[model samples]
Target: MLHYIENSKTQVGKELVLMDIGAEYHGYTADVTRTVPASGKFSPEQRVIYDLVYRAQEAGIAACKANNDFWAPHKAAAEVINKGLTALGIIKNETDKHPYFPHGTSHYLGLDVHDRGTYGPLKAGTVITVEPGIYIPEGSPCDRKWWGIAVRIEDDILITANGPENLSAKAPRKAEEIEKLMIEESAFNQLELPKLD
Candidate 1:
């Protein structure tokens, strides 16, 4: 799906594209998502929100373990996100009631984007997605400096005997890395196309 944001107040805007891809090998499927700035470089406000979400995702990943329930990662990430919004003065109090962060931090990932059976303790072979996002719709009570910024960071994770493993870690998750990667030309760009009616 595509989410476009335009804000005169923040003096910046972005066409955010969110995609989920799945591949199968030996009858097993994997799902992953990567979000990047359409402009190739994040504005100051965008960077702030993106970084906060990145940190929250890290916390969520850390919570993935054989001993923790499926909801543990959500709880850990939500705590960080809620506190971050408050510390940035985006909200009135230290609470997770903020409308900006409305979704759970994770969900099962396998053959489907949201796989089934995400209820009890996580299993060692289970795969899940840790995605934390902030969406500030226009005309909110917050200052204009924080207007029209939306960011979502997602990674496919595996609960292992040692700890959580980021299967998509090779993908760029940081703002700088994303910007650099975006600027590089892709091999597909060189493909020749024939005019067919």
Candidate 2:
């Protein structure tokens, strides 16, 4: 994305991307996504929104545990996202349901990207994903302080006898961490390819 933004002449306005990646191994699947600034460093507006989703994802992951209701994570995540939006003055009130965040947090992960599992109490060893997002396009009802910014944080989690374990923990999720990763020299950076006429 940094390369694209730097190399291309396209002007950025209210454009955002929500990238989803899933890999299947041994019949099980993993799903995750991270939205970063195409310019490598998050702008002020983008940072706030990104942090909100990150904190919400953390809250959702904490709710994934044995014997807890399957929807607990979603509820937990929604509450955090709702309150954050309210506190940031992005929305009118925390009690008011906002369309900006309209998806559940967790789903089973197995044969399919959205694997099948009981909506009842979560059992130990259940693999799931905790993803929370916020999307605010240009010209929305809210203030311009929160426009053209879209963010989603996702991580694969596993229910354990004790608590939740993050399977994709190695992946960088924090704003600073992402910035660092983006700036690091890529393996392909030094390779030169000859242009064909």
Report the C-alpha lDDT of model 2 over 112-149, residue by residue, as the tens digit.
99988779999998899999889886787889878778
Q: Which ten residues in a row have the lowest lDDT in candidate 1?
A: 1-10
Runs of candidate 1 with Cα error greater than 4 angstroms are 1-15, 20-28, 194-197
TM-score of candidate 2 to 2 decimals: 0.88
Q: Please write out the lDDT profile of model 1 over residues 1-197, one tens digit for every residue.
A: 12434432343247555555567767666766666777777778878888898899999999999879999999898888888888888997876377888888888877666778748899998999888888887887898777767788888899999999999899889878988998999889999999899
Weakest lDDT window of 10 consecutive positions for candidate 2: 1-10
Alpha-carbon lDDT of model 1? 0.81
Cα error, candidate 2, residue 37 (Å): 0.8
Error of 2 at 41 (Å): 0.6
lDDT winner among the candidates?
Answer: 2
TM-score of 1: 0.85
